[model samples]
Target chain A: MRSVLPVLTIVAFILGFWTLAVVPMNIHLAADQAARGDMVVEPDDARARQEVGAFALALGNPAVIPMTYTLDRPRLPGPQQVVVELWNTVFAVAPTSNRSLIYHGWVTLSATLLGFGMGTALGIALAVGIVFSRTMDLSVMPWAIASQTIPILALAPMIIVVMGALGIQGLLPKAIISAYLSFFPVVVGMVKGLRSPDAMQLDLLRTYSAGPAQGFWKLRLPASVPYLFASLKIGISASLVGAIVGELPTGARAGFGARMLVGDQYGQPLVTWAALFAAAITAAALVGLFAALERVTLKRMGMAA
Target chain B: MVSVDGNPQGLEHSAKTARSAVISASSVDLTFQTNDGPVHALKDVSLDIEKGDFVSFIGPSGCGKTTFLRCIAGLETPTGGALSVNGMTPDEARRARAYGYVFQAAGLYPWRTIGGNVKLPLEIMGYSKAEQEARVRRVLELVDLAGFARKYPWQLSGGMQQRASIARALAFDADILLMDEPFGALDEIVRDHLNEQLLQLWARTEKTIGFVTHSIPEAVYLSTKIVVMSPRPGRIADVIESTLPRERPLDIRDSPEFIAIAHRVRDGLRAGHADD
Candidate 1:
């Protein structure tokens, strides 16, 4: 109850503001339609009336003001309209059907999972390389950091075009872009974790006559668990964003990003807002799952997560 | 006062009277080349440690005692001179698992439980599971932590944690035990109790032990031989042989013989400072 109260209050506040915003955003069209209807003194000249602005006209007419919530094509959909659209798209169609939000969600989810796996592997490998070799530490670490500085927006289209040129149409190109965005965090995190063992601990390993492989397995790798899971959380969210971004530029016919693009092009704000909320919720669920895993792993390792 | 080269002869002659020498160092020196300049950590240090001897290196801070111990464990290499463990190079002896080392801090892996920490060296050396379990049990009992095997290192008191570290070193059953200020962090009462326990453990196992400490009473109470060292280019200031008997209780610290040996150690430390 303590945590939920603040969330509820914030949601109610946003909904109230959104309901008020709908009036102003759709007021012009509502007024124009009302002016051309039976209430108008003239048919063609009603919208061109001299005295009042559209907002003022809508405010004065009760019927016109109410039309803002009931518009078929609104600039910004009301909260109730978005909720209804979400309910219909998620439940009304078969899960495998193209029209269902579940089908689109699975498409995005597949790419995100695949990208996250590849990114995690690449990041850990690079981190190991950076930790053990001074050459890689001096050379590759700077490049890894520099790679993230390039805007993903600018990079995503280029990756899509390059993969399209190579005749790879779906999934792989998006996963590659996702891998590119996610690997940096894991690299930085694992480097710190691998080096977490202090001088005395290293000396202990030496006294045991343990080799580098033994040192890593017994000390560095186990030491890096908390860090690895922390990085994975950040990487997974970035992977989801990369998948959505990949869908935007490639003119995708399916997925959450495609649904948003289609709704935007057709001026159906309800579809777009519903898909946006679904993407957010999916990202939250992914982060939550990893958090659960981190708690278990760290606790088992005798580390307080 | 004996010169550095003159003292090793007397210690060797004494060591020859009872048991064979296990560790012999002659003019061993280590100078760390940091970015600022070369700083000498150990200089012209010579010593002979016999088998079954409880040898303690007592010194002020920056004394080469810890450095010399690390060199024995093959964690650091000396820049000059000869040091040997069990008739081989320090590195060779390390590879052969001839000694077990306890650091100044507990240094237990937090991810591992007390039993797991004790089993670590045995695991690395490829001991069978049953053997590893038996050894861990025996050492835990040796440290009086037999019931706390499943507890994490952080859950234990600092004194218990250090004992757990000692248990870890004892797990492998090596002939020599190298401990660097294992109880230096504990309270005085705890330190005294651990000292008594350590002496008992040493008596039972008869392991050749090399210990480092800053406390003169600790050195006098626990050692068959004491090597007093000084800082700023660390070197041995004095070597004192204890005439006290093997069996020592907590009250033995107040004996005149103990005080006489401690005073000699203090004079050696003063002499090292006078040279500086």
Candidate 2:
């Protein structure tokens, strides 16, 4: 209840401020329309309006604030309007329809999941290589860091063009992009986690005459679990961002990013905002799911999850 | 190929008389080449530990006592001279599972319960499931930690965790047990209790135990033989064999013989400093 109260209050405050912001952001259009409809009534305090505040003046015409909420293409849609739009796009359309946020979300989600899986596997493999081999540690790790310095924006389009030229379309390109973004954190995190065992513990393993395989399976691998999960949370989110960016370049017509592109081109900002919110919620859900898994796995290992 | 017949020391000769000497280190030396310079950790270190002997290496910090124990466990290599365990090279003996080692810290895998930590070695040695369980239970009982086997290392007290580490060492039934200041981290009261329990444990198990510590009383009361070491180019200053009987009570620490042995150890430490 205590946690819920703070969240509710914050949401309410944001909505209140959003509603107020929409009036000013859209009031010029409303005023222009009011004038065009021959409904302009100059307030008695019109001369004093400049000093009294624009909000006080806007409050004089109840129709103006309400009209702002109903605009065809509002600059900043009111909270109620966004809520209504969210409800309509989610429930009013068939899930398979192009207009349905569910369909778009599913498309983006598929790419994100695929990319995340590839990224995590690659990251762990690289981490293991780096940990076991000093040459890989000295050579590959710096290169891995250097790879991220090339902005994904510049890289994504090039990848998309290159892959598109080869006639590889849909999920693979996006998954590759996601894999690129997600692998770094996993490598960095897994390296640290695998090395977390101190000198004494390593010596203990030595005394047992444990082979490299046995040491890795019994010590390094289990030791890396908490770190792996931490990286997975970061990697999964980065993968989602990668998926969205991957959608941006291809002029694709299916994913959340594609819907956003349509809304952007058509000036239907509600569609763009809805798609943005859907992506955010999906990322949050993925992180939450992994956190639960981390808790359970670490707890079973007798560690503080 | 390896012979230690030249040593004129009575302690060295007594080990030969037993015909069951488990560890023999003759003129063994280790020099660590660090960034600063060469640091001689052990030099001309000669000793023989008979089977079931409780040998303690007592020295100040950085005195190479732990280094020597590590060499016996095959965790460290001597740069010069010879060391053997159970008539085999340390490395070969290690692979043959000749000994179990307990570090200063409990060194329990935090992810494992005490029982699981104990079972780790058994698992690595390819013990059957039933055998693993039986051995883990037996060792835990020996360490007075039978009830706490299911608990995590963090859940136990420092002393209990150290005991669990000892239990881990004992779990595989190795002939030799190497402990590097296993109870040094605990409070005095706990250390005393663990020392007594360790002596009892040694008496029961009859494992050839090599312990490293700085505490004179601990060295005197727990060991059949004490090797006092000195710092900075570390070397053995003196080796004292206790004349005390095999059966020792907790009150043994208060005995005149125990005090006399402790004084000799202190004098050896002081003399090492004097020689520097």
Q: Best candidate per DockQ, number?
A: 1
Task: Give candidate 1's root-mean-square deviation (CA, Å).
Answer: 3.5
Instruction: List the global CA lDDT of all models.
Output: 0.88, 0.87
- TM-scores for every candidate against the unseen true structure: 0.91, 0.92
* Per-candidate iRMSD: 1.0, 1.3
Q: What's the lDDT for candidate 1?
A: 0.88
Q: In candidate 1, which residue pairs get closer than 3 Å at backbone N, Cα or C atoms, i.e. clash? A: none
DockQ, per model, reads 0.72, 0.67
lDDT, candidate 2, at B248: 89
Local accuracy of candidate 2 as per-residue lDDT tens digits, B12-73: 54746458668998999999999999999998998888887889999889889999999998
lDDT, candidate 1, B45-101, per-residue tens: 988888888989988889889999999888899999999999899999999999999
lDDT of 1 by residue, A4-92 (tens): 99999998998999998888788777666666566642223643544556566555665667878877788877788888888898998
Docking class of predicted structure 1: medium
